[model samples]
Target: MDEIFHVAQTRLYCRGIYNEWNPMITTPPGLYFLAVLFGFCGYERYLNSLILPFCFAGLCRLRRFILISTKGKLKKEIDQFRDVRLSALAICFLPVLLNNSFLYYTDLLSLTAFIWGISFNSSLISSIFLALAVLTRQTNIVWPALNCLAISLNLLKQFLFNQISFKQLFFKTFKFIYQFLLVFAFMCFLVWNNGSIVLGDKTAHKPAIHLPQLFYFVGFTAASSMPLFISYFFQNYKKIFNRFSLISMLFISLFAFLSVNCCTLAHPYLLADNRHFTFYLWQRFFQRHWIAKYLAIPFYTFSAIFMFKMTSEIPNKLKAFYLVFTSLCLIPAFLLEFRYFIIPFALWRLSLDYQSRKAQFFEILINLMVSSFVLYLFLNRPFKWPSDPERWQRFMW
Candidate 1:
């Protein structure tokens, strides 16, 4: 369904009809612009496949940036070169990300732009990528804005603590603001677009304060990176369980129950679309029984707590900014789509301080298996819709 609009728009661009627009397509035209650069390509899917290399390049750059950022804290056992390469490969094959890579969707290109924006050291170049990111997807504006805020907050703390002179702080802040101008540009675009983030599909993509999205996102990170979570659990199981008293456990349960009971939202698209895996997940688990939603609370709690524990090794400044940015990104969306969780999950997965070789190997193996499974289902398991019997509907993430 989404491919219909994206592929058509790119074809129009290929024909030199740059003015054409699709009202059903909610994202900006950056993806189409990038697709046009391939000179119409061998096929639309092939053109989309070209974006994967750029994505991998950006991921490698991001891994290098992470290694440099955590160099002092890195374990002596960590093999920097091999670990970086494998980690980038593992992330490139993440189920949701890899599934979207072959489609004419904004997800891969948007993520690539965002990753380069974060990884690049040059302010002008970084801002260019960041602006391109927002041009690909309007919601991406929040990330650069959050990045700017994080830098400012960190600098302010350093200045306050007398660790950095006011002169140095002023120069650093200026450099950050200059590099992350995407946020400012995006705000200007929003005003020009009549205060709407999405260019089309305004009715369907309505903004709401759906708080349960945070829970769903956390659960997704936990599930997607289960190998690391399991490793963390075994290494710190005693410390983890010790933090949870009976009363704390009860409080967590009550909080999860209320969140599920009061904050859960069923979007119209989520209910109507069976071609996407989220629909089945909703129908099978969240809607299967009255207590099914409540049952998910424990998993959510476990994810949130353990994820926090895993990130405890990051610097205080970065950790605070990461949490703030993640919450702001996920808290407003009213949908349960897994694609929305991809960027935040990628950042979380990359920034972890303890990704041993064993964890990386398991991560790659599991992601490969899941990616192959989903690809098989998408290709071979086609079902016909009664309303459109001529069209084959395949399952996807």
Candidate 2:
């Protein structure tokens, strides 16, 4: 308890103007204010540090309510509370509760920023949180960028495809550009105020560029681009693909890949151990190891085959072509690495919404269950049970 108190106190004092050089204890100014309030009680300091951001995120949602009310747009049928609760549950509870609650990490902040951005549609607030997320941990950079790109693409779609009138397209483009400028300006302000951009202590000494890191980054890019290539090939061969759908798939695939990669790469210890390859392998195997993972491939292949079972929806010729393409492209890929194949499979499944909800639900359930089971087995057992016997026993107990 005393040690915890000392640590909290040290963090508080380190935030003082007099201790500007201490990089280890630095936190965002927003978090620092909360730290000052609860610093006397160490645990409270940490708790409050976590709670305040969540509170601010709540306030951000509330601001949206206030906006709607002021505009006299709040309707009885709106059920603002239900909407808020659902959003909170999905954005906050789903990821944090299932994945990494109590971690006090940037992921929470990233999610909050994401939710806040969606809630208010205020680029400034969203960009501020995103910038803080990156400053707190560089891994968070991808999500914000991806989100912005998603919004940007959606706007582009509206301007180019949806809007029939030139005037309407011009107006929408201007609105998007204005919002984007606000976000960009906010980010610039944050970077300027933060003095030195430090990812972490490990990165503080080294220059940003490294050759091996670049190579791995290139590999990740290639992996992400694979879906685009597949989509394009299908389109060229008079298959099911179209430009809009292809772009959307590429965006999502690249976004997910980048988000996962950035989060993984920011840790020096992970980089040191070449955990990238291990993570790649895990994803390749759908989070399983050698034999079990290999066995799962046949099941996955069967599932992919089932995807084509909805052939009644497609023209016979196109269906035949798609089946042949699926066999040649998806089967070989699934056999080699089911995890990598799963993304494309999912994209294709989602594309088939006109098929049937029941079918989609079953496909999704199977994918989730298989993937989760494999992950559980990998994380729990790996090569040997009780890799750390003490930790394993404690976990069980």
Candidate 3:
């Protein structure tokens, strides 16, 4: 769906018309620049095909980072290099990303940049990749911002725990974390010139206080990670009630209720673009009836609880940073696009240590199954718009 605009923009870039801009395109021209550099210049399909290796390489880096960071916490069987390779291969098949990889979309490269930004051992290189990520998609600025916040907070934590002296903390804090500054300066320029985060299609992409976007994000992720959720439940079902107090449940339910009732949004594109799967989802489920949103509160609450449970093994400070980073990424978008969930989902999935190979296998299998189904529908189930019968539309993530 978005490839048409992206292809045209890149064709202009291929023609050396770098000054041209597409008002319908919201992201920066970094993706098109990469296309030109890769010699896929005017050919969208070739560009998509060429990006797969980079995506795979980024996923491997991500797996290594996760393994090293959580060394002793993982099962011996699951920590092998073979398992690492397998997991990276499986993650490459993630439904949303795998579907987009065959199309001329910026999401794959944007995700690759984000992955390498967090996973690289050298901070300088990581920062540069993060800067490129922000250039590709402005929303990606949140990751570098989160990194800076996390570094500062970690230093404070070390000082509080007497793991580092005040002088050490001071020196660390003063160290050059130029990515945040660079991104901040670039954002200021954008705001000064364009007057908004969105460079074009401003009306459609304007920021909103869509609180329920968090719920949609959580719910979608929960549904995607169903295997993990199911396995976690079965393993802990006996103690689940004890761990979850009535007051906590009540509070979560109340928060979910308020988020849905007060801030549920329906973007115009979400309603009008039947070519996207979200349109059918919204029509058939979320907006089916007045009580539908209310009915969804329990699912949201459950999803949020399980997500917290899954990440409970991470350091408390890092967990807090994770939540804040995820909130910053998801809570502002007025649309319910699954594409926005890709990076956050990748981070969450890689952070986890799957207790059983069975669960891991099921997760991979589920992703493959869904990707195949989506691809089939997208290719074979074309439909025509009533107003434009000559044009064919297909459902996609």
Candidate 4:
């Protein structure tokens, strides 16, 4: 609310187009517009309640899409839709989604647009929803990127089968990306206007690698999602070192560098106080070589294994794209927050089997418990939990 009120009072595109309290114009105007709408309704909280129903509505549409996509592959036609839809709902209620829905955050808005984008069959509709998603949260460009890759691959397949010509595929690709040009232009405009795309006063947000935090993210994210695919990882150990995994390895290595340079992070609570530790590890550690080798590499490699095994059930063509997409979402951030892992976990959890009621039930229960812990952290966590930031930076993650 602090940032919202600060931005709300200002006329956009006016003279001195930056808020000293929360400058940089990092976030596009979507969330601010929604905040102003709810502010008029005069509610202190529970505004997410109004948006919650729409999120569920998006899930319903997404569930139908999932079922339709998985059709005839499953054995029984009669029970397939029910089971698939249940699994979709199960994923939808995971603590991350539940928690985000209660807060006045952009996660739900971006998620709604994302789910609806994937649900729609038309390229135009999908592009619009994805464009809105990017507007809501700048990092959401990955959604459109993944979509463009999928469409291009499909067009290639069509051309190979003689269903479409080379010229036709080229034009289609151009048109698809062009439809999203407005959204991209708006992002460029924000960066152009902000003068420094880095949010807030530059002094408040230093950049650092902090490989230890990346280690924490991979381990926590993997455990939170569960070990359902651990066996497959071992069984296909040799085959797992494919092109996609190689690319993923290089991507993680690249992430460490980009994050250190402040190139990869997006809206780490841009409008809020810069309370988060950015160059935290550098402030304390003289050396973190042990961490990069033993911690960062192992956790990141295992995450790739888990990602490969979990995504095996999905069609092969898009598997590599989703793996890259998932990695792109989490790795750029300065903070190692639980909320950062939600997007990847939510999408992968959809593949869980609803037939095993006990398994599904337990999964939801575990996630809910984690959600409870996160809620506790949000509500009651002490500011002095690690009062000495520089001294305790290693343990911060």
Candidate 5:
């Protein structure tokens, strides 16, 4: 039975290849060539095809030089060595590991690259991974763009605040731009060589210009602006309500939630094809479509409460007012379609706390876990409760 299933799977993949048209290629040559080398071994080929290379790249980029020493037993030493940064890295890797290790999906490759890009502070690497992500699946385009944009904006803000000089900022910005361009060009070249203009033959889809997408952007901007907004508010007001920093953090949290929800609403689709909007609409309206929509409320609620707590200056009444106003403005699209808003809302909230190492670490860990788990459950079938004894035992053991 297993042999028959294997043969059938091979034939299916072969058929997919034979019917391939312009830009309909399965994956980049880097992945394809690897796939071909291991093709004779069936499933092993799929595993080796992307996983090996991804693992290699990931290990190559691991910053072993930052290690700290401790006098303790191996386990104790290792535990202590896993600082917040390492913890953050582990959190980032967990989702990709789960996806690739269990499901054999290539999506994790790009995600890994994205994580590496951020971890190593390598724009070029990030761009390359993002391009691969788009090639693997187009819906991933927003992430690379948003990530780059956020970094750029943060640097710009630092320069404006005299945290960094204009000259230094300019050079850094230029380097990032150059790296992005180079990676993008290489990806395009690879696509062209693979007989595909874009990543896959799949038709590209886009979201309809709707209130939801708009509100998502608004939420994103508000969240991103939280620090500045809070700072501005506090400077103007003599006394802090709850705390100036916390107020700023709230905006960011709201933004992150809204952003994720926005993306969820749109359904991540490639840019080349024209059918993305259809996918977005279908997912948005389908009540039981994905776990992301269902989990959004709790995620956003947590973020909202956290933000409220972070602010020290705003009186409960004012906080209530702020929350109400912000929610009202942001809720329209999110309430109508929740997934499209959650991520951005969370990211926005996160940005406010980025200045604090502890806060930033927590933000990254929570967001990564939440996003990854939701995606994993949604993609898998025969949904079972996590508390099921067998599943829980397997996970724990």
Candidate 6:
């Protein structure tokens, strides 16, 4: 953050700020411009710290919007209470969000723009926020457009089902294409102004077809958000396996086999260095051990199932959109990074439109338990996380 603020303070050229003379940056210049807006104060980090307040404010607003968006799906009484309940459970319990906000990273702002962009009703207004979302983080381009993609997909479905005339479909498509073109124009300008997409050492972000990194990301995300609908998984496991023809198990086996034989795709400097909370414990006992990696694949496989099955009860349009969007979000990544899962996680938490009342109730209960447990753990225990490897050992990779 200080580096970002310093870059903004010293120079205005986006690419130059990240060139060999300065710190490496993989994102667009929106964050630097934002830091400029905050103004140079007592210290660069101090100015950065002020963003946390705005971050939480945006989060509260997002929660309000999410609640309002889903209000119509529930009964009048439940509508009044459900959003607040779900909001508390999902937001308060999420350690990643809390940590990200606490660290005053640019993610909160990007996330704010993303939720606002998707939830806003007006097309022009939504486009503006969506544009802002992409500027905040390059990866956000797809997130803000998810609703549009879903709508577009739904339109195609309508056409396929003979509910909409060919002319109507074409007209809507043409209209949307122009709107998207405007957004794309702005993005191109920003990227050109920033000089490059991967602003840091280009090799750092070179795309790879590694599946293990993606597998880990999927598994971790599923585990983190499992309390949302885990009861359904437990109650219908047998049916799910039978109906799905052991497809879930097959995916599990595939990833497990890959984990042991294939290389682990993880970042050395990602989130407090390479060894984070969960991976730290895994590494302590099973460092470089293929068995541990293989064993962890099943857990990830369950998570993948949970995530894929989240919107099963919702409209197939939404399900298809999510499937495509989630894959697009992960496929290009060279290594595992939890931030990549943020958008899908947000969408997953908001997928309550077509859920049963009982499912909603249990989900709320699970959230409460999880939130309470997280709070309890934080309040009552001493956190003993491992420090970074001494002087960045080569083996750390």
Ranked candidates (TM-score, high to low):
3, 1, 6, 4, 5, 2
Q: Give the poorly placed runs of model 2, Cα more than 4 Å off.
A: 1-34, 37-87, 90-104, 143-198, 201-289, 295-397
- TM-score of every candidate relative to the true structure: 0.89, 0.38, 0.91, 0.65, 0.41, 0.69
lDDT of predicted model 3 = 0.80
Task: State the lDDT of candidate 6 residue by residue for 108-168, as single tens digits.
Answer: 6676667767665666777777777777777677654565566688899999999999999
Cand. 4 Cα-lDDT: 0.56
lDDT of model 2 at residue 340?
22
Which residue pairs does candidate 3 place in steric collision?
Answer: none
The C-alpha lDDT values of all candidates are 0.80, 0.38, 0.80, 0.56, 0.42, 0.58
For model 2, residues 1-397, the per-residue Cα lDDT tens digits are 0123334534655457424433443234333333455563344335435653573456436434543543446444333443333323322322112222232333344344433443455555656555554443333343444445656676677767755466765665554454455446546745874633332242333323221232222233223223333333344444434565456455544544443344222334323222123434445553454343334333333232334432224445544543343333322211121122222232232223122223323333443454455445435753423444443210100
The ten-residue window of minimal lDDT in model 5 covers 63-72
* Tens-digit lDDT track of model 1 for 1-397: 5988888888888888978788999889887777777675436777657778888878877766677677754444454455667767887889998888877777888888899887887888888888888888777787678777768888999999999999999888878776555677777888998898878768888888787787899888888889889888888788887645445666766777777788889999899989989999999988999888888888888887777777665787777777777777777788888999888887877777656678878988999899999999999999999999998999998
Best by the TM-score measure: 3
Spell out the clash pairs found in candidate 1.
none
Global lDDT of model 2 = 0.38
Q: Give the TM-score of candidate 4.
A: 0.65
Higher-ranked by TM-score: 2 or 4: 4
Deviating ranges (above 4 Å) for candidate 4: 1-21, 37-41, 71-86, 149-178, 182-187, 190-217, 227-303, 351-355, 377-397
